[model samples]
Target: MATIFTPGPALQSNSSEQNRFMEKLMAKILSFYDEQSLIDVTFKVSNPTAVVPAHRLILAAASPYFENLFRGEQGNNPVIEINDIDSDTLERLITFCYTGEAPITVNNVGAMLKAAIVLQLNDAINSCVDCIMKNINGYTLQAAYTLERETQCERLKQKLIEYEIKNFMEISRGVEFLSFDVEKLQRILESDNLNIPREEDAYDAIKRWFNYDVPARQEPLPHLIACLRLTQFDADFLLTHIQPLPGCELLAFKAISWIREPAARTKISMRFTEPRATCEETFLVICRSEMNYKLLQYNKAEDKWQEYASLEIDYTNYWPILKDENILFIGGYKNGVSCNIVRSLNIRNKTWQNLPAMNQARRGHRVVELDGKIYAIGGLEGNKVLSSVERYTPSDGWEFVSSLTVGRFDASAEILNGKLYVLGGRNINGALKLVECYNPDSNTWTSCADMTECRVSLHVRVHKGHIYVLEKYSANQSSQSVERYDPERNTWSKICCLNAEWARIENVFSFDNKLWSFGHPKHDDISSVSVYDEDNDRWVKKCSLPNVDRYTYNIVPVALLSSK
Candidate 1:
């Protein structure tokens, strides 16, 4: 009895009483929703009716339409009617206005969104957009696209475009792609980010879409055919495929003009060439020393590493196999001077050819390939770390493209979603955690998220549309952690920490649909290869380096054969 009287209010003893009070208050508020309490409003639209028992003051305060009506001279009105919105959707919208939560589903989202828009409910609008996002796909896109257009939903429209562009090739094969009209077909083919590896694939896909209902779709042929990159087709494919198609006369003339006078052809709407299918995915390891360049590729048939191709030169450098017949070796310290000699070797003919030298000579640079073009990003040009960038094409030789936003040597680069991504590497300022993305379509470089830790000489590879980066040089921690970047989410997460420390990771590439990092294991002099098994989420050792003789092979150079 003394303990109870000791405090003004026994806070601990009444904690349960507070919960009981809230529960009773919520129940009382919920009872107001019943018609028995007092029905005040009715909403009708689209053949549905909602009879809601609610206080006019609460409803007016939550919704703009109600506010506009009640703020007038007749604020005391008891009954109100709302139109242009169905009863079930109005119920959800009204409930959301009261509880600050909207109930929405794919089936009723369109109706709910219309009600929310009429009532000026932003939260409900966002909720509906999210509902569509979770459920929107090939089958539902048409309906979703109509709803977005009707309501002027910017976010949903962008997402629809992105989904179409991101999965263009795959979407073309879907049943819904079979249902696409000419305008929808143009939307997909016109996107610069379309993942069409070959132009002919897009042509064939459009033809299939056109032939679905020939009489109805044939009229749009000229409009649709104008978008194809007909110039990318060889004479045979163009003559046989494009010429034979009806209503392709204008497109054929444009194609011929593009070939004869490509620079001066103004009427022809030539498409930016999509990446060609250059080669099958393969792994190549390049070992460098004072005057030796030995390349080894994973021989899948023998299930082991074998000698691929080699070029003896006077430098340390970066070289990756073109994944088919050719391999490239670029700028490095040649006889103690930064040199920019770009060399290539044909595996089939065993011949070597030297392309045009880079705009500048640089050592310790990262060389990457995208869409069959090679780019030489930042490296040490003379005594200064250079941010200058250059591109090489077989037709044009070497042309300087955009420079890197940050100047760093020995950075890691990879191509994902048709963009060049450069990750951590050392500059004169030291190791960088900066991540930047270069869009080939725009020729612009923009910064992305930094790494979990500052790193230099890291290894990055794209596997199944995700970029995986491994810490090759970091003093902060030796946990041997790896970071994975999802381009879709624009975020990075620390993934598997390897069992063995990644020391002097000479090369890392995707092989057999799995990420493999090669170098000497922790505290071991001999180099080995380990595969990251997604099923087990651990690094599984596969085999040793092709060269067990450590005496000659010191610096290992690597390349991923992503294009043919």
Candidate 2:
């Protein structure tokens, strides 16, 4: 009958529809392989002999190797010998050809990778490589390295190398590390990203690797030693450990010569003197908002302030000392009185721990860590400004070390040349230009050169063998000045004057290897952070702190945080 045939609604060629069709088609194809239907090729793999049947059409479509192999001759159920790939890997590869996915895990990734390489299956190769990288650990690292080298995969090689460097301390002790060839080890040692505590540790690692099979690795000692940052080693380390080595005497002496001659230090290789990526530096700002105490971390690179921690404390003006991974908030004023409550916040775990209180209830004091001990300098206790100083050690807790020459609060202090230098602060008689230096070795105070101005609530920072003091704004002062103190010369010099816009500066500190001052402009609510340009001798405005105003922010540099 000539009946009109009405076409049903045509399906949409959208991405979702295409994806569903492909998914169903893949399921049907995999089912065909599962049922061994339409199979025209047999792969025979040897190590533990087995056979896998796959469709020649599907195999050729997925792999260039199979496509090129079957282009000329048409054969039914052609048998192919695979001596390199085992039976299980061949099955996995065939399954991936049907379904576009395989069970690529760490254990079988190397085998599958080799099989994919042999068959020239690019998708399977990528899947195998991703699995190896994602699951790489101390156990599988060396094998992954070898697989990368065999395949010449640059991405896999770089990932493995970075992992090795970051985890060098632990991996250096493993037997797998010993399997690294001299070239590989040399490349790792030459990297500045080796997360080692010191250059000596790299040398020690090389020594251990060499001593494992000395006869085999001894000839490469000089080559490996050259990769070390020899200038970082001291004379004692060089003469004691390096000179005794069989072939490292020349390297040791040359490093020692560089260390002895300051001018000749420039001639030392830059790679050898570049610092390792052992620790990170960050600015931790503590401020009081309307409701709670907020801790902010200034991301200098991004020019952004990230809220790090929030504490429900009824105190303001607490000092944060970066001890390992913890920030020790020492003493603060609570309810119109100074309290000696010490609290530590572990930045890694975001846990708060209460530490032993200081000997005196002191606020407006500065704390410095020197030689593994914490020294709490002068601060006021109630109405009386105290001249007492307390030192804290793990063994002794808090004890009186030495008293300051003058009792004052809101003063600035820093450690220089193993001595504590306390700068100008206001006493009961108003501000004083007095500076005192306390030597821990002698347990006595010595007078240092005084600042040019009487500074109260000033910020003191030590940089490059000098102490920098930036004064707070006052109604009487016309301009805020930054003074530099030479510890060796025992003299004070004015480095530069702060911009009039920064007259109401709140805090000045060292962060990211530069002297920075942060405050708001006069009659402004937004706080500005500026980095001191040493060469230009000017404060270049960088960015503004978030959620913090001019009057309430307390900022400090927290460089290293312990994983523990």
Candidate 3:
């Protein structure tokens, strides 16, 4: 009955009208199958109404392979399975196929690589590898290496080795890609034309592979040896590579290749030079009220100095006397009295205790510790210049030591080469250039040598077995000339000079093998504190001191604890 009705309705319509209607329905069905085939091959092949053949659908899906066939014509429609490939990866792959350009983003690299591998697309895979190697940094190395490993792509791994991808090797603890043939790796390491990336990971890998504990009878990898000449690499990286080779053979090769190669030694030396302390580690000039006479503990990581305890006595003229695990404060003017009081605050216990007073009343003096004994050198005693010196031992208390050859005030004392070197000071008659040395063994003072320039209120620091002197020549003029003194030869040589503003200040201290000067109070216009570089023979400006008020006072830096 239904067939009879359908035939009657078809017969009732005009022939041309019926023909147009059938054509329209067929067009709609073809369009639906085409759209579905573009979405997924499985969806198209499984669809009950799909009219397109499965083989044709598969060919359309791989349209990039037959691109030359449809170079000019409007060819068969491309049926890319969007679900099979990630949308971003699919877009990138399509762009690469069309224009031979691939845009690599971190998000789509993995999916793109997987799709390229699955489709057996060699160019696409290489493009993905190139993008990954080019953009690899510390953050992305691990992910990239993982992708390469999973794909089992030897070409990608070789590209990584060629680039010397640092990020991948630096953080990798042990041998990785262990399954990779050592012979191929050895060949790569020995290659002359290959350029390896100066990354931390590459250095670590090269070291682990070549510098084994037991000596290998196999010939050394020449390419790895050549890679060590890369000066752009970190010293720590070079050290890592050469240190494991044992007996300094690899190190010697590195030195010859890197150091002796045209100003390379200078560059290496400059890079390894110690860094200066920041404002946080700098000793600020704190006033009497600010000087709590507390045991201050230095936190290295935090780069901070904090007071641990407070003292009852005033700290006006109380300069940091002797510093060890405990800090000793002696011969400071307390209230109106010039106190000869000797006190120490244990940094560990955070407690203060009184020791015996000095043999004589002394203020404006410097206290130096030599061989576990404290010596209070020349200072003001009631407007009289005193040459008196006293030694303080914990067991025997304070005893009179040998006095200075000349009585002076506003002087500076430094312990160098097991001897006390007392330099320029303002006697009753302006500045004096007298440089004297005192030997504790002989209990005597001998004039060794004189400074080239006369300076009062100057800063003296020792660096690299040489003493550096910084001072102002006159009230209006300051000298930045740094004179390096060698104790062994008893000779002086001029290193690079700093700016006048840095040398003018009295607040200077040496720590961590670098000389540091605070910002000059008279010259606050200068924003940076001065730091002398021994290797470069120059002075650099670091972050300015936090509190500028402490620029005028004597700054002392004590090594709280150090592990060698």
Candidate 4:
């Protein structure tokens, strides 16, 4: 037995009672909906087998679509044709007009929304948009995007972006993602809101779309590739995945130059370095030793360093350079010998390849990239210091550049303000505070203001247009202090002193505007790492390296890549 909460049925007062009375009234009115005794309008749906009969008053009172039709009618009975929407969708929409509610699923949300839009039923269209949002997923996201795109549904489009951004990586891995229209894909890529942790994922998505059917999709590659941050993708990724493609020739060359010159990033319209561009920023650490080199990637989510590979050569005293997913070991010592074997390791493929060796066998030298060319300067050769500078151009091999005034070894070098500046290193003078600036065009080294302190064992980097040097305090390196040089004034000032613990910091990288140092320092023996809170001017211990081995590891040469 069903409870009749409507009491006497004389127009209920409570909300629930009103709903019940309305439903019952709708059912009763719908019972006589097609009866000829009251029938005045007939609708012929586009589906051949469908025809619906309705009373003029019931429809005219509920919908302007039928109201306008009835007002313009000239005969006793008029047959109206609704060819825009098929019968099933129209039938449900007609019921919704009377009942003030409609039931819909993901499969029919598009059709129902379409009919409601054509009928000028704003309420029903809102209901359809809500329904679409509730059911949107990887399977239906693209369809909803396409449908709403055509319908111009702004509310639904916003819901689509929120739902789809989190699943971008998953969507790219799907076959449907590869099948999206080039324009549609580009629209999605244009968003700064995309949650692609790695710029590589964005690049990979485009590669998949182009290669899905190369012969047919080749034409759109140019337009689509324009959306990626190609310059940010380093050299190996562009070479392996994009550079080899004949269609990517010009784009690849421009991207390579872009990597070398980040300031002139006008060629590409987008960059992946923004705060919201990714979920987690990924970085790498190059663990170098006299015997071998190990590549480790630190995963923030996992809070651990996973080794990428162990190379076959002794990269000790090596000058490393990164081009995308690979690192170049340019003229480093192998087995205590100054070897000029220039090799590169593809971090993605874990494969090594050799490039043309330098004109002179060099180790403990400074290598820096400027204007798309490599310059190696100042290093020791079997206890003897050499200043023979050489320039390397891709495909052009190495050419002799003007040598440094004083022979330097173990010198730290970084390019800044369009000039290569080599900082503190051991010259014949020993642990000198010498600072010199090298001009590529002029091929000359100009002496600059020396540092406040000297360093034989030092960690040097250029950050925010300033050169920072960490100098050791003692033989055990238990105490240390840092000084930064302002290029504008060519002056060095002491910043802060670090607990001798940082003496072992082989490599350092800054993320989220915080400094991260990698390596175990001194008697701490346990591999220790720390993060420098710039605001406090102090180092906060972050974590310790895995204690899998008794051998203390030396980590250096850090690079920032996409987390994915």
Candidate 5:
């Protein structure tokens, strides 16, 4: 009994050794499958002359669909009738079962993916999905989108949608775009992400699709036309391009009504009043004094400036947001008293309309637009820093939502990835480096990684999936530094500094794929615009703006006004 085998320490399995064993085993099984040796099952495909013979044990080990089917078989060898899978797909799947690989191309990837999904072959399914996504292009987008929809692959479907939206200008010119069904075309036209320069281009695309086969496409023309922001078009386009369309008479008339009479927009559908993702934006400045508030628009193309509109009301430090063809001015001060008066300007007609008032009166507050609603964040009311927040919906009036974790004024806010981020500000204690994030879906606020330096009166802008914060420059610092926040890593990194000449930065915004800082230098009478040179990681002076006193200049957020 003492001579019985004594166990020693267990040996660790090496990955290389395991891989070699699997390779040899797979080679042997592949040979067996290729030679039709030890074949125990036959697949009868839809084609009369096509039949596949495979080893039962290998197929049973590969997929659970086959394992369950074989387990229920009443005989040693069975003939399976497959009406859904073709002969070529069946052979490829069987080869993958033995060799762990399949020759998947764009031509056959859709069919192979469908067959693999039906057979519950997870490895083959993933391989086919990868192949389909790899070869997706403007020419193949319709087919890929249809396949993803049919297979219920939600993630793949989203990728297809993004591809179509980003490449709509090219895809709409291709033959496959004409072949898309009405539902698919309608969905594409309804998206705000379409890379179109103007609403006229969208109408042109729809007309082209309709003219391809007028008789068959006429019925869906109106539906497709409704998807466009018809009101955004000018009168000349409405008469020459839209009115002449086969089935767009009603749409043309309604659009003209909204354009001529701004009040009609209240009755019009919000879909037609919304702006596309590519709306043209420009810098808007408001210089305020005792009773004078001047509104100016910057012309970047010509490096010129012009007066935009004259304001009748006197409000200081009010927040202005551009929504489609309108500009909304939220919570500010009137005669040194905090007020909740909200004003909306329809720039097309130069008309101002009164919106619902905020619940709390505050000045130096931050306002942002998300999901077609407006949010007014933390600010100072009287001598107390308030943490109250309010949201204004078009369908509903202003209502209070979740308050900030900390009450501070002069803070900067930006929307990134569907969430609102409020950065550094000043409170009773002093300047703050605290960062907080607000999620509208959960109606809650949570803290984020703090800035490297405590700051106030900073400006934040989101560009290309990153948030860039412009810290105000003072005499102590050589230049105003810019820090970028990476949401994926939840960290902040200093990218570069602004021109040392800029003694202070009043606002930071993105336009034409560049970050522009608006401010003036020390002892300078006129403000200036400096654009970030990303290639060199430094700010370059673009041009000087019209003279405005830095003490009286109200830094309005950049406005993305409708070009129409």
Candidate 6:
């Protein structure tokens, strides 16, 4: 009884110590369970007498600070348990939380994003997104885009937009020669608040970010002025005193207004250069309701213009070709004809002839001349989109070639450095911005850099080792937009747009060392002859085509004499 007098204080101290010990024990147990679950393993003593401490295991698992940091309210709920996630994923997630060193390939990024969202770990979520984006390719981009759309996570969406913009911006810079995916770009542009920044604004932004010296007061020089500034002057007159800059060309005073006329309707034809014995640069255009074609000739009697001749042939949904000095027109609706026929126009003899018919009648087909052979590319063969391609040699006639990865129509084809470059076209379902290059040596097509815009029925020409594409904005509409591609750099640059009335068709060619385009004018009263001077970088007007008018025009440039 006497010893018990002081027992109250002692008992109180013991009780406090026990409480603390129990608290520590619970924490250890929790950590141990967490660790065991994360790694999908169990720890047991080798001997029955040896007891493993639960607290130590728990502590190891809970040591990752990020787990607790991102736990938020979820951590406060004592009954809440972590879901079954892969051991590696859990470990990586924990590591990211602790040290902020994001795992390069954290599979199930969407799930991680969801977890980050729930945990309110903004940094972790952003890091995961960046990792996903860095690894995304064409195959993954669509999935990523879909995921972003489904999640509706504001941060994720922002990140995606940022990624797309940055990627395209970088692409735009390096794309001196590019084929754009118009639909993809349009989607991006539509989804984001992207605007066409003024040149000054772009320059300013570049200067600010790069900290490079930029001309403070860059002046807008006229095409003539710019031409005079170049150092090399050999064949300067080839550009007609117009400096053919990458993005800018000379503008003809009269041609400008003609292109600007709103009432120009959907078809107008113009003739460039009066037919002369010295420089017989003449064009005849006919714009029908459906399509148009041009007849162009280069007369060298004056030794001014090279002797070249061309005729534009129009067909309903297929690319027109010139074979045996005759226009082989494919893919168009002939009222009673069930199959598409190859309508030929003899340029040399000035007559029309029908040749061996296509096995599968198609529209919007691409015909390319490679190695003295003509290959008919993807288009609508009857009502079906076709990936099948066929080749025509003087000896073989029409024979099937390998099919493309995708079916395409309304596409443009050009030969560069002995390879076939097919740029911006559409499929049967929609418009396309895909760029494919076919190598005859390899007998295969490989994807290449894309363009900044999506356009069909664009005017494409190769000049001075560059590809120039003049694209209209819409079907049955006129556009002033132009783009140029440099195969050497594999990049595309925006060139000065043509006047609005200057429609796009297969009427573009390099004549007299200059770019000449003939198409259906947008304005009824305006002419269609568009001449681009590479030297002066300007456009000029010649006489309008006297005959043959149509909506869609085709031109075939024939060399009367070998320039070589």
If ranked by TM-score, best first, what sequence of candidates would result? Answer: 2, 5, 4, 1, 3, 6
Off by over 4 Å in 1: 1-282, 308-310, 321-324, 474-478, 534-538, 546-564
Alpha-carbon lDDT, every model: 0.69, 0.76, 0.57, 0.71, 0.77, 0.52
Q: Of the pair 1 and 3, which is ahead by lDDT?
A: 1
Per-model TM-score, in order, reads 0.48, 0.55, 0.45, 0.51, 0.51, 0.43
Q: Which candidate number maximizes TM-score?
A: 2
> Model 3 — which ten-residue stretch has the worst lDDT?
271-280
Candidate 2, 1-564: lDDT as tens digits: 678855345544466776788789888887888898887788888878999998888888888888887785544447877788888888888888887889988778878888788898888877777788777763377777678878876656666778888778678878888878887898898887787644556876898899899888778888888888776655656776777787989888888888677688767653465445553356667776564677677776787887777777777656667664567888878899988988888766778889889889888887888655788888878888989999887678889877888898888888776678888888899998999998888899999888888888887776546788877774445566778988779999997566556656777765454677777666666777788797787778776776443234433323233333
Error of 6 at 183 (Å): 58
lDDT of 1 by residue, 123-240 (tens): 7777887888788763287788678769877666667767887666567776777877666678777765565544655776888788788888878876777676566654545555
Specify the poorest-scoring 10-residue window by lDDT in model 1: 550-559
Q: Which ten residues in a row have the lowest lDDT in candidate 4?
A: 550-559
lDDT of 4 by residue, 111-211 (tens): 88888878878778889988877777632767886897788776676666565565676778776777677766877776766766556667778777887
> In candidate 6, what are the lDDT values of residues 149-234, reduced to their tens digit?
67667776666656655453343343220222333333443322322121122222222322222232123223212212121121
- Model 5, span 11-86: residue lDDT tens: 2346666677778988787788778888889988975458999878888899998888888854355688778888
TM value for model 1:
0.48
What overall lDDT, based on C-alpha atoms, would model 5 receive against the true structure? 0.77
What stretches of model 3 exceed 4 Å from their correct place?
A: 1-312, 472-479, 488-495, 521-543, 546-564
Report the error of model 3 at residue 520, Å: 2.4
TM-score of 2: 0.55
